[model samples]
Target: MPQWWKEEIVYQIYPKSFQDSNHDGIGDIQGIIQKLDYLKDLGVTMLWICPIYCSPMDDNGYDIADYYQIHPDFGSMEDVDELIVKAKERDIKIIMDLVINHTSDEHAWFQEALKNPDSPYRQYYIFKEGQDNQPPTNWRSVFSGSVWEKVPHEDNMYYFHSFSKKQPDLNWENPQMREDIYRMINWWLDKGIAGFRVDAINFIKKDQSWQNGPVDGADGLSSCFEFTRNQPGIEVFFKELREKTFDIHHCMTVAEAVGVPYDQLSIFIGQDGCFSMMFDFNYSHIDITEHEEWFPLQNWTMQEYKEKLFLSQKEIFKTGWCGTFLENHDMQRSLNRLIRNPQERTPKAAKALGQMFMFLKGTPFIYQGEEIGTINNHRLSIHDFDDLNSHAQYRRALQEGYSEEEALDFVNRRSRDNTRSPMSWNSQLYAGFSDVQPWLTNNEYYQDINVAKQVNDPDSVLSYYKQMIALRQNPLYHQTLVYGDFISLESEEYVIAYMRQDDQQTILCIQNLQNKETHFPLSSKAQVLLSNDQVNIQNQQLKLSPYQATILLIE
Candidate 1:
């Protein structure tokens, strides 16, 4: 590997929502190809696209119908090849999603497995005979249902699904199945695509016996997080996959890892590693109450958020590489959800948060619309919801005693649909996404927040982000930002402060997360290179206005 991933700014593209090329109201490969220049000008180094593989779109392409083929809605194999060619020309590497934890029930392999009980394909899934009115295991699916769903055709038999029942778990225990997966991965890498963002990668390995899991959370169904996910034997499978596919291309693989223990960080991303890096979810997990099923209704304090994120950055710096991100297809936008008031959500706060994470000792992944302060929509009613996860959480909340209105608030605040909403391209009908109706409703804020306006405005959040990326990639800051050790400046509430330093220069970062002014002194005369707010500095210190931030280079 060329260590290219360490220095890259990864921009995530949700295909169906990114752009509509044919005015068919669906984003396709052609749409992506047309926007390569936009991404290049934005200074993005790599692209992490949500699954474009053949799928039912049940979970928005997470339910894969075919591993190697492009989804008809997106385009054909030829369009994919052209995208790779165009992206590479702009120095933009394309990273596809690898959703191998489960395959769509409609996939040929799964269909064949169901058709013939004696067939070799039968061993390609986790089908078990029911025992004494019990499921194959007591484990609950991540998506609010039972893990095992009965296969009515096969008397007394059931198959496992870690997510939706429409998506059946692949039998990773099957050697043949592993071989097939590797072959598909190699095929993509061979096409000159840079690498992959492996989805639900931790779920690929589980305890062989579907034994009872320990109840560790407030919600009744214990989080299979402890025992079922990232279980002991993952390294072997990852090593094999790496040697067979990723190693050949030196591909950047950022495993979508969540519950992997801090102690195991090095093992997964060591210098001699199983993956180039894995996403650090400490900030996200901070809100995960001791409840298994609830979608964390607890609001986070600013200091708590700071500590969780800083700890993960510090942990990765000590052990191995990590993926730095605030928003993704699966979560709400950071600017909207993280800030208290929309009025207080200034471009300064946006830029500072961008710089704080991007300069960490790892790769930074930017979710779509994060550049120009894309807030989640408030008009979506329960009936308007499309994300299955959001629906499941709403039902779970009602079951847990929240009123209908209360549950609705949870969905509006936390729905993945918040991020999954159609990308706002221009101030047109449906935000210039398409001429026809869109798969999901566009955020109404798109009227003022579209890309066309921000792309040209020097003071826009989009412009600040463009400047931030360029600064990180600058000849002076590139090495420090990519490889510098992270050191925390404080542990107090509502304040996140750190410094990134190499042999040449030391960069001081401070953010006033609260709505109160924060004052702190610095060591020497330092140039304020970046700020989420206007700066006023005096003798060795800086006064951060409410929700303000500053990035300084020491003399």
Candidate 2:
């Protein structure tokens, strides 16, 4: 190792929605290989692809079956090896999703467990008889209902699923299971992947007692976060995982940990802990109500938004590195969903969002199409959407007596399917994602925001992202952006501005949040390094025209 990842900009590719090279209507590894040049042109140094492992597709590849085998739908293991080679040739590191929290109910391990209670594989999964007609405990799945699923063969018995019942939670209590996981991690590392993005990692270690979680709502489903978030013994599991897999090879490991508390974060991701970084989900959770329902927002208070962001920054910025993003495969597009004013295309607003997180002393992840200022569509019906979360939420809204129109608005505004829309390669039919039918419908906005048009436009979001990537890697900002301590520039409203300072220099980044003019007072003479605005920065008092962002060089 080179600490390349520490200084790199990662682009996340959700394969199924990325490109369909063979026109198969599904994205495969070969398609990813075909798109390497496109990714290269965008200036991403690392590629973090969602899982391509063999899966049942119950939860869209999260329900893994064989860890060692690539899904046939995605292409062969040879294709994987070839993609790795092709990516490395373009100087891009590749990281695969490591979803070890659970295996699909269809996985051989689970089936074997179901067949014979005495079988060795039974030890790898959680299996117990339901007590008193209720789930073994009240821990609810993050999806909607109880986390436990009763095996058909074993009457009253159940398996834990943090999401879908088809995905059974693995029993980390078994030493044999831990060894197997370590072996698999080594196998992947040995194959030369740069690292892993551990999925639902906080759910791996649970309360061994499987005790009832405290009731936090009227629904009666116990809050899993109370007992499931960063359990007392999870660090040991991660430290062991790090020691056997990451530390040994020193591979980079980032985690999908949403509710990881501030006090326990250092232990979960510090230098000696489980991962190199953990994604900050609080920003995405902004739209969520106290009941975790889709409550429409007339406006996001600039004061409140700034304070919520600062809480995450203040907690993780010092003790541990953070992974920042506006959207991902599991969330709506940032520009389309978060902006109060969608008509502005608000590159300034988008850039300000970027400025808020990118300069926050961490590795920033860019979801595909996000670089092109992708937005979510409000017209797609519930029937047309393929996302499970959207479907579940729609049903819930209907059950709660919301009218069809009312439910549609909430679902459209918040569905993760907004981002799952196919990558717009061109203005062609199907957005050039597939020559055949696509896995998901492309947002009609693709006609204006396709990669073909933006790839050639210097003022495009794609170009701006490339420029920011360059600034972060540039010698001046690399050290300062990565290891420096982040400090928020206290402001009244309309922006989230911050400074990253090391011994050498301090990099100030200002982003405008409102769809109106905003100004930033810079104490020293500053040079505009990067700006979302088409106009040049002339005066020292930063002038931002609605959602404009400027990264500055100040002494």
Question: Can you tell me which runs of candidate 2 are displaced by over 4 Å?
Answer: 1-3, 214-220, 289-300, 534-540
Candidate 1 local lDDT, 1-555, one digit each (tens): 467788889999999998889878899889999888989999998999889999998899999888788998899999999998888888888999988888999999989999998889888888998888767666667777677899976677999888889989888889999999889889888888888898888888878876777654334565555555788888888788788888888888898887777888865787766788998876775555543344546677877787778778767767678888888998877776677687766666676566666666678888889888788887447989899988888887786778888889888877888998889989989998787889889987889888999998988889988888888899988888778878788735877788889888899877777677878887788897877677898776688787676789989
- What RMSD, rounded to one decimal, does every model reach? 1.9, 2.2
lDDT of each: 0.82, 0.80
Q: What is the lDDT of candidate 1?
A: 0.82
Cα shift from native, residue 317, model 1 (Å): 2.3
RMSD of 1: 1.9
On residues 1-555, what C-alpha lDDT tens digit does candidate 2 reach at each position? 465556778999999889887877998888899899988987888999998899988778989999999998899999999999999999999999999999988889888998999999888988877889877998767766788877775678887787788888898989999999999989999999999998989888777787887775445777576666678878778778887788888788889987666788877666666788888776567777633567444355667767878888888855767778778888877776556566766554555666666677778899988888788877647898787878777776676678888888888888878888889999999998998878877887889878898888887777787788888878867888888878888875767888888898888888777777867787887777888775344565677777778888786
Residue pairs that clash (backbone atoms under 3 angstroms), model 2: 348-547, 348-548, 349-547
Best model number under TM-score: 1
How many collisions between residues are there in candidate 2? 3
Report lDDT (Cα) of residue 243, candidate 2.
76
